[model samples]
Target: MAGVESAFPTKRLSVPTADPQPSFLVFGAPRIEEAEIAEVEACLRSGWLGTGPRVAQFEQDFARWRGVTPSRVAAVNSCTAALHVSMVAANLEPESEVITTPLTFCATVNAILHAGLTPVLADVDPHTQNIDPAAIEAAITPRTRAILPVHFAGRPCDMDRIMAIANKHGLVVVEDCAHAIESEFRGRPVGTFGDFGCFSFYVTKNVVTGEGGMILGRHEESIARARILALHGMSKDAWHRFSDQGYRHYQVVECGFKYNMMDLQAAIGIHQLARVEANWQRRRQLWERYDQDLAGLPLQLPPPPEPDTRHGYHLYTVMIDETRCGIGRDGFLEAMNTARIGTGVHYLSVPEHPYYQQRFGWRPDQWPHAVRLGRQTVSLPLSPAMSHADLARVIEAVHGLIPA
Candidate 1:
């Protein structure tokens, strides 16, 4: 397919680079400072490292940051864990259908399937590459019980329309906020709009805990249920059982997975959460630089946020036009690698994966927008750890490699 140029294109800039960069620029290195190091050290010193006070504090602090009550948050091992527990809390019957976007990481769909629900893929919007609310509404059927919308590349989906459709259909809404810790829709955080918001703190996500996640909800009962489910369905978590008061016995209430986040991870999260906004500011500046520097290239930069929305700027993704750029997306990635600049693909559309294709018999052409984006999209390195020189190297490498 031909590359689609931006409507407001600028003159291309020429940057000369005789040699590849001396050192490889990794795509998503966690920005670990003295504070993160000290916090983790403190956890090691404390010895109450397994799902203890630090995890409790992180959850409380996260809830306060999101303007939700502390009881509304449940800390887990990964966003996948959060999503799975949220689905279980939703109490949907086995084989119930979940309408979701195809333009997300497989974990989003995998959670649905793991929860014994059918994943019904909805095509994405051509511009935002987000689940189109119209497509979601169209895909809903009598068997549909939930809607899982991913905030792709940290851009918030059209929640107003999605919420309206979900409300009209009486469907559960589980928001996949893996890339959207800093994203907001009309002043409200992305996760707060849905019935349950699942957030990631993976190495590459906006916030880094190495590997952790949180689930946010408004209802106390559901949040309590998620808390129990996250820790193996125990009547009492270890933190409560072995507290200074006494050793309390715990009973298994139901069969559940061990998805609790450790205090060691939460120690990192506590500090990461503290500086997330500042880190987001840095990423926003870098995103703008990429926008200005790569304006006229044979690429489609990520869409800007709509009015009144705040983008997380988690991943600076661009779609390559092979014909115009004189290279396919994979070729572009290799070229970037040769220049010692690391890059990534946010995802291939869920149905395009071999597992999904063979299991569901999904065709790539069924969701044309998702298929196209999946084929063309490439994520440039965008992280708080990136220095100004690192940004310049990436910009220069991109300009030098893509044909004018």
Candidate 2:
């Protein structure tokens, strides 16, 4: 497929003389409703606000949504926690290397370090901003035990190629689906393709939990292990120990982290999951609007979903052409802020971060595509909560900044 920059010709848009938007448009706001609020209030009143019935129900609901068995999912506090637990479940040896894309959140790499594993950076595909399978193949080494592919901006990664490479190398696959709750590739969900699929339900995610995540997998034993590891390695969960069966003593089977999700967050998630499809549809409409409105400017819009796939439309990111636009990505961001519109940088590649550069001795030149993307990419406001007026304001602000 052609890269995003060459996918469309830049069209010239007329500049507007109107004053900037009067109010600040916050990016990625959760579409909270009375149902969410009432559920949370009920959870608080029940006083079983910890990981109880609500969390369990949320996990089951999530599993059902993903077409997976309930036992294959483990709910946690954050995607980072889910990733860490996944690493443990995979049983990666200390110092084992995991090949992953540089175009991802720090947490994606941090989880590897936390698991006592080395993270080997692979560059991303220019078009999708997702880890390229060829880059992953080249990064593989004798010590490489896994491949962590991130579904960038809710677009499914090329999982078929990734699975083939993993199978050839006998490597585990842990999918980072933080932006892909509703994403599917070739009729299957993104998370189910890997040994472990880590999902985020952060406030900005397609599904809002305020703060939560879930791990999905096919291995019953791995999922069981993750459940134990997510809650301080207890053999029996709180609910199991204090349920109708009276106080049953629990055992500390192994060293684990406190990463369990609470009912308060899960209360929001329960309703959020129920409305996820509806919310995704709304986001798709907004994404289409942005694509239509922002065309012809000196910017490269996000590529369309791959064939036979469903996009979650979690984020609508664009790449600015500094030379053509007369402003760099940072400059564009500042202009948007001045115009009372909120914007975000999905990420600067992992190698660009000082810690990774110094610790791993990585250079930006090592990953040309990721470096270019890191320099130019910008995430525009995209959410089901955004109104048509909000969309218009964003379009007007962006067009006003770039010359026709």
Candidate 3:
């Protein structure tokens, strides 16, 4: 609460700024183009639509993007699966403690639970909306085996500091890069600094794969095991086992899950990854435009990206404190919906959810910064698919909704 500002001085609009657009503007809509459509069509026609050539190609392309070798990357079904499989592949001991940010999506914590490890939460920095390095340091314990830091809103966490802390304590670093495909810190890519970096390609993600994820690991052996663990722990995946050359026999060496990415999903991801930079630039433009247009309003726009770091430009989130803006966060969301515009709350602090609160016996007050930020934060429409006119409508709606 000390770091979060609940009020800001600004004026209210006397009348509506503009009428709502005829069609609803979807939030976080990915820019799916003809290239993706064509690739998907080609995949369907090829008939190898499961875990096959396309998924392998996507892994190679993603590895190149992250500056990692193909052997160090594995494509999975979702970031959640990536995180879980990575943890299992890392050989973390049962009941070990994993410290992570409380301000992230529940999947970050659930992955820890699914891995048979206990999750420990550290508060986040309200300004950067990232896991505070100091909080992570304080959260360490004798049983602590790793730290999972989410790059909230696509802003890279303080990896330099986080990795340093991990090194000091001999803890594994697993980066939750769900919002950070194109992000970097101090000239290094995000997933490279950690032992394992998990990425998301959900429909609304910077790179849309309908539903897919990738793991970028530092060690080849660990990543190879991760690949095995992702697809039923078999000695050979389906493609290798039943190729045109021969029908090879296989063995199940370890218990695993059905988390492998399908060729169909990878088909879309391939084109999406190819256009990642172009899409990021478009989102960056939209983000800057929003900052400029909404500066005069009573809202807390995202802080500027740190110097020497490349923000992924994933989600453009703003804090809408009721005391300052005369409208609660939910009220603003409803108002946007009524205006035929979609919006989102990036998250409610992990403790705010009933399941987590009950399971962990946690309370919102334990992480005051996360609770405060989560309650007031709203994700605006920052998709690369949006046109200039769409952006204008969002800004006008925000300006028009200010209570007098």
Q: Estimate each model's TM-score.
A: 0.94, 0.94, 0.94
TM-score of 1: 0.94
User: Candidate 3 residues 1-404, lDDT tens each?
Assistant: 67455475467668857855589888888899999899999999998999999999999999888777899999999999999999999899999999999998989999999999999999999899899999999999899999999999899999989999999999999999999999999988888899999999999999999999999999999999999999889989999988897999999999999999999999999999999999999999999999999999889999999999999988889899898999999999999999989998988999999998888899899999999999999999988899999999999999998742
The weakest ten consecutive residues by lDDT in model 3 span 3-12
lDDT of 2 at 302: 91
Give one digit per residue, the lDDT tens place, for model 1 in 343-381.
Answer: 999778887899999999999999999999999999999
What residue pairs clash in candidate 2, if any at all?
A: 11-296
Tell me how far the alpha carbon of residue 197 in candidate 1 is from the true structure, in angstroms, after superposition.
0.2
Quote the positional error of residue 127 for candidate 2 in Å: 1.1
lDDT of 2 at 63: 86
Q: What is the lDDT of residue 394 in candidate 3?
A: 95
Model 2, position 297, has a per-residue lDDT of 82
Model 2: residue 397 alpha-carbon error in angstroms: 0.2
